[model samples]
Target: MKKTAYLCITALILSFTLKPSTVNAAASPVQETAKTSNHTAGIKQEQPGTLEEPAASEKPAPSEKPAASEEPAPSEEPAPSEEPAPSEEPAPSEEPAPSEEPAPSEEPAPSEEPTAEIPVQLLGANAAEKTVTLKWDNVNNAEEYVVFFLKNKTWIEISRTQETTGTFSLAGYGTKNSFKICSYNSEQRQTGESSEIKVLIPAKIKKLQTTAYSKTKVKLNWKAAKGADSYYIYGKQDGKKYKLIKTVKKTDARLNIKDKKNYRFKIVPLFKSTLGTIAGTASETSYKNTEFVSMGHQKYTYSEMCSDIQSLCKKYSEYVSYETIGYSEKGRKIYDVILGDKEADHTILVVSTLHAREYIATVVCMKQLEYYLLNYNKTVDGKKLSDIFSNCNVHYIMMANPDGVIISQTNKARWKGNANGVNLNRNFPYAFKRDGSPKDGSYSGKKAASESETQAIVSLTKKLNKTQTLAVVSYHAMGQIVFGDYGGKNQKLRSDITNMYKIARNTTGYSSAANYGGTSNGNYREYLTYKMKVPSVTIEVGSVSCPVPKYQYASAFNRNKLLILREAAWLENNF
Candidate 1:
């Protein structure tokens, strides 16, 4: 019995040694659970917001299964330990994830696509209607357009439209209307913009001047306004509202009026565009039938001469003009009134007032100029005055010695020399002889051509002789005579002088005298006769004295007015 019991214990110990242990198999699961719990704790520390995913991952850990494949979302899910949390994503938070940093910013960043194109637009203004119109071509992908105007250099929205045209009131806007347009999408986001367009009102007219030719005719002229296509001239009678009388492209307009009615005028500059015509504002002025040149009843001063010259030139612009040949010693202009075509081949030079006291000559010459201008289109002696003088230009040196004339009229009634006390008649270059120092009367200058007056005359004569067939008529005072003989041997020249004297004799019934022999003191007629071979004569008018009285002017003008025409006619026919 003891031997059988020991054999059984050995058999039991051998069986225990042959079988696997149950404690290790049971402890394996517990060890794996502890490992998974530790891993889950580490994951929770890394990802604080993901508690559910960690617990779900821990439930499969005790089975010893791979938790990565058992996860509900493997490709869609983020491993928090390896990747950023949902808070770090750019979609949810301000801070962006590393890989998703450029996605949100780069996906919707096509704002520059709209700014690529700039549209060209048109702007029109109707100043009369007080409206401005903006028009432009349709832009691609543009749903609507916003019109904005500049206010203190900043653009402010004015209107919005789906079409390409818009209109706005221009009452508050000034002359310079600056505007721009912007295109927008359906969401009202700006896509593109147009260049600024300026709609400007035409500027008002200035320097309005009126000239009355006669009781029935008037002329209006003004300086050109900016952006003006034409000028609208309005006329009113006796305090009535202005009515549009004419639209003229030129800056000047003429009006034919009734004999005795007071009229007012205003000129509005008109700007034309494709939309409509607009008129600018203007100031008003009255009209009067006023004569420009005086009737010689008052003392005609230099100022009067300038005024008359300006008016006459403006009225008779077709046949009349003037230029300053030279200035006097007192800085007064020496006016030469031209009364014919400037391109004429022949010239008739009429000089007056060489002696200061001989002012009647200036008056007579001015009357003659006016007479010719008045009868310019009239038929006289088989031809119109304009036609007669078409080939011959009459140049009137109205007052050669303006300084001397001023002195004679203002200071001394008998002054003959210029302001320099030099006798201009004796200061010519042909037979100039310096007599002595300057005195009150008849004092030759220190040298030939010393005085500005003498130099002007000499220079003019020389210039005329170079290009034209020139004849000179010099008018002196208080002799009622004509100097016909220059003592030259040229037969044709003598004949021409004789002919000129005959014309003067028949016109005025004046006497003839041999004022210029071959040898003489310096004389203008002698200079023309000998040096230049030009036919010239000196006619002395007024029987009583120098500075012929105003009453004697009518007779002098009546006799001399026809003299100029006749002489011009003779030259045109003969020379």
Candidate 2:
């Protein structure tokens, strides 16, 4: 493998080159050519009424009565006192004189001061005010109560109120605060405090972050504070306390701060409380990175596909871009990875695995993407791949039906429909018909393009048509044939399908299906041709089983290497 790069150019001329990362990232090289790739579509607001108090902070209610024992039974009468003369303070433990001649039974000595049950709950979590309101059951004969706030870990009397509820300002208290209340006899401070109500306040935000763009501007972001209605952005200079800079309407605070070199930022959120506005703690930026991009996924799950494509766009942004072109039936993102020059005069759209059992097509699409990007600058047959990209935009729609792909992966069954059980391949608008009921594999969906996957394709093509989409190639598997027909509607195509068919046959050596066309109802290829006025072809990659054996991946790649280039090459010349 010495001079590998040097040999790569010649090796490309004689054979197709395959790389591991390219295969790993694209789909599963052979297993998931186009992998069957969850979505909950909601605003996801934090529902209210989830307020909670600490377990230790909870005060027991005053309704229950104390049990029988009144006092410690006088220590078993001091071991029955053998005639020893008692000391001056009565041995410091004996009950006074036992009443000189009075009997000890029924002394009627239950005169201990009544203790107050502390407050049950605190109000004002929703209060706009800075003070916390204390609430508890009222005790009879109690004239008033005193509230103590924890200060420097020491209890200090904060307020006294005649009513059952009283408000205590968090002001002058440290970040952590707790409170306790005691009932007063006619004079206050007559009894020990009821159980303490510990108040917990957040001290700081979790993760304040900053991302530096290429310019002098720094993009600031912070995790949203729970129950926050809005956030305040603060800035600091020269190590001083951060000053309030701007008030933002979202809990997820984001802004671009520019023209400053040595400075920092802090974020504080204003949470909603009916008692007024409850506030959360503040966050601040720790650091910033200008060149950090995340890694790709190991598996092409629906979410993994989105994250991986996003990573690619960040890392290879100059050559690659991505979009949520549409969604699957279950709302999973149908990500479309666009490569080559966007401003190119011609466009080629590639799709794979409309059939879930044939997800291997997705892998092919992914590997093709990886392979093309790596070799775009290298020459093949005296033509640089980069030069081809300069004139043609290639769009790779990996795993057109994510719902079916996932189902197939999990159960290892034959599923060729979306999560709704509609066959997306047969759900397009053209030649629409009821294929079956919702739970059947051949279900054509209730209406044409009813599935999100189909609609995404429709919407994508409509948008691309404005930019001159010349052709589309949807990859399927287990047939080993490349052909063009939309229910045999090729006669009405804008251009003859003969040349395109020939190109596919030449590159993959798959048999041409023009003479023996495989007809299907409400297919994507038909819709693309008839409605979009764009030539679309279906490449049935191999004649193997549903998954097409892992060893057969090389055959899949060898057959479809020039699939896009050939189509783009044709479009560049003929269009």
Q: Residue 70, candidate 1: how far off, in angstroms? A: 44
TM-score of each: 0.64, 0.47
Local distance difference test scores for all models? 0.74, 0.63
Candidate 1 pairs with clashing backbones? none
Tens digits of per-residue lDDT for model 2, 1-575:
66766554544432222222222322333323212110122221111101111111122221111221112223212233322233222334444475565442212111145554454565654223445666877766677776776667556766777888876776521243567676666754354455656553333455555534322444565566544557778877555677787888754434454343455677776653322444565665533322221112212455555655655454344578887787676777788888888889889888888888787777667667766654565775456777788898898888888888888878646777778888887888888997686565778888898878888888888878887746888899877887664444456463546667778888888886767644467978877777667787888875777766656665677678767876787788777
Stretches > 4 Å off in candidate 1: 1-145, 148-186, 189-215, 218-228, 236-243, 249-253, 258-266, 280-288, 295-298, 515-519
Indicate the TM-score of model 1. 0.64
The TM-score of predicted model 2 comes to 0.47
For model 1, what is the alpha-carbon lDDT of residue 34?
A: 50
Q: Over the stretch 423-531, how does candidate 1's per-residue lDDT look in tens digits?
A: 8888888788988545567688888888888888888888888888889999988778888775778999889988988988898788876552333567787888998
